[model samples]
Target: MSATSDAYRIEPVTPAVKDYLRLRQQAGLSPFSEEAATRGLAGSIFGVSLMQGAEIVGMGRIIGDGGCFYQVTDIAVLPEHQGRGLGKRIMSALADYMQAHLPATAYVSLIADVPANRLYQQFGFVETAPRSLGMAMKIGAPESL
Candidate 1:
């Protein structure tokens, strides 16, 4: 489909508890269902998904402590469906969710991956300077049922 003629249906994925787990793995991101099942988790997560008919094409989420900080996370579009600005749409949806619920003074952040970092930059995200840096510690690999 040509850029001028293609129109995609963008919405948060629903009734997709399983497909959600599969797509996240496809994007090389880990699933958090076991953690999510716990009744009172410490963080808040707002998820948005992009779909085409019955298939989930992309997804993103915001996770944080609900008060002082938030992070834009898990943004992904399948390999065959990328280059069409779907990731941007997902981010915008998550951004809108954030704007509606986040405190004015709350800190919003994310860790960008490779070329995708360029996309986040368009939304006024700047690299934190010498005082701060992105870091992480991986746990056990994802276990499937």
Candidate 2:
């Protein structure tokens, strides 16, 4: 498919639990339990779903305190739908939301996977290495302790 394909459109809506799990798995991201996903989604500040007809082929979300902090997370696209600029479409919608709703000093950040870091850069995200680093630990996982 071409970058400008009209076959897909980005919608400003949170993806349903099923679509959220499916897309994350299909896109090779970490798995989250249904219960965890459901609880997490309810806290979204803003989200976008890339749709084709009635199917969600991609999705992204922003979550955090309304005025002081925000995180860009869950950016995923179905493996079959990758490489068609759909990710860009999702990010564009998200960026627009952040620009419009987030306070001036609100800090926004994302822990991007290697190659996808390039994509995040296009939306004004910079690597905060040298001085600070991105880190994470899955709850209940041994490594987290």
Candidate 3:
């Protein structure tokens, strides 16, 4: 479906903190506490919300320092809203933002999950595995060390 079909519209506004958290959870992403989510949402460089009337059904955001680095994160669509190409629409908006605002030398990255990686690849995201693997450690979580 088109990005702005009769059923939905993509708004170039960050989802409210409540909607952000709800979308993340409903879309099967890891949960974040309200305090953490509030701080994180405030730091979004750019974000979009997929709206169906008054309700937010999907979202995506880019976060990083304004110049050298950025990460496409929090891409999520409601389960009932999946299979409608909304994810591609969300990424298209993000790609447009990156092209228009980010520097040519800037490094944009995202940690794609499973089949969603295919969607990201269409946007020119390549696997960095074998050269530099992605790694992470949650704060306050038990460390391997």
Best by TM-score: 2
Instruction: Give lDDT for model 1.
Output: 0.71
What lDDT score goes with residue 20 in model 1? Answer: 60
Clash count, predicted structure 3? 0
For candidate 1, write residues 32-83 as lDDT tens digits: 6744523212243677668776677777767778799888876877777778
**After best superposition, candidate 2 residue 21: deviation in angstroms?**
0.7
- Clashes in model 3: which pairs? none
User: Over all chains combined, what TM-score does candidate 1 have?
Assistant: 0.78
Candidate 2 per-residue lDDT, tens place, 40-144, comes to 999999999999888898999999989898999999998778888888899999999999888999999998888999999999999998989987878889573
**Preferred candidate (lDDT higher): 2 or 3:** 3
- lDDT (tens digit, per residue) of candidate 3 on 1-145: 4344558899999999999999999998988899999999999999999999888999999999999999999999999888889999999999999999999999999999999999999999999989999888888774641
RMSD of 2: 2.0
Report the Cα lDDT for candidate 3.
0.93
After superposing candidate 3 on the true structure, give the runs of residues whose Cα lies further than 4 Å from its correct spot. 1-5, 142-145
Supply candidate 2's per-residue lDDT for 114: 88
TM-score of each: 0.78, 0.94, 0.93
Error of 2 at 15 (Å): 0.4
Q: In model 2, which range of ten residues has the least summed lDDT?
A: 1-10
Better structure of 1 and 3 per lDDT: 3
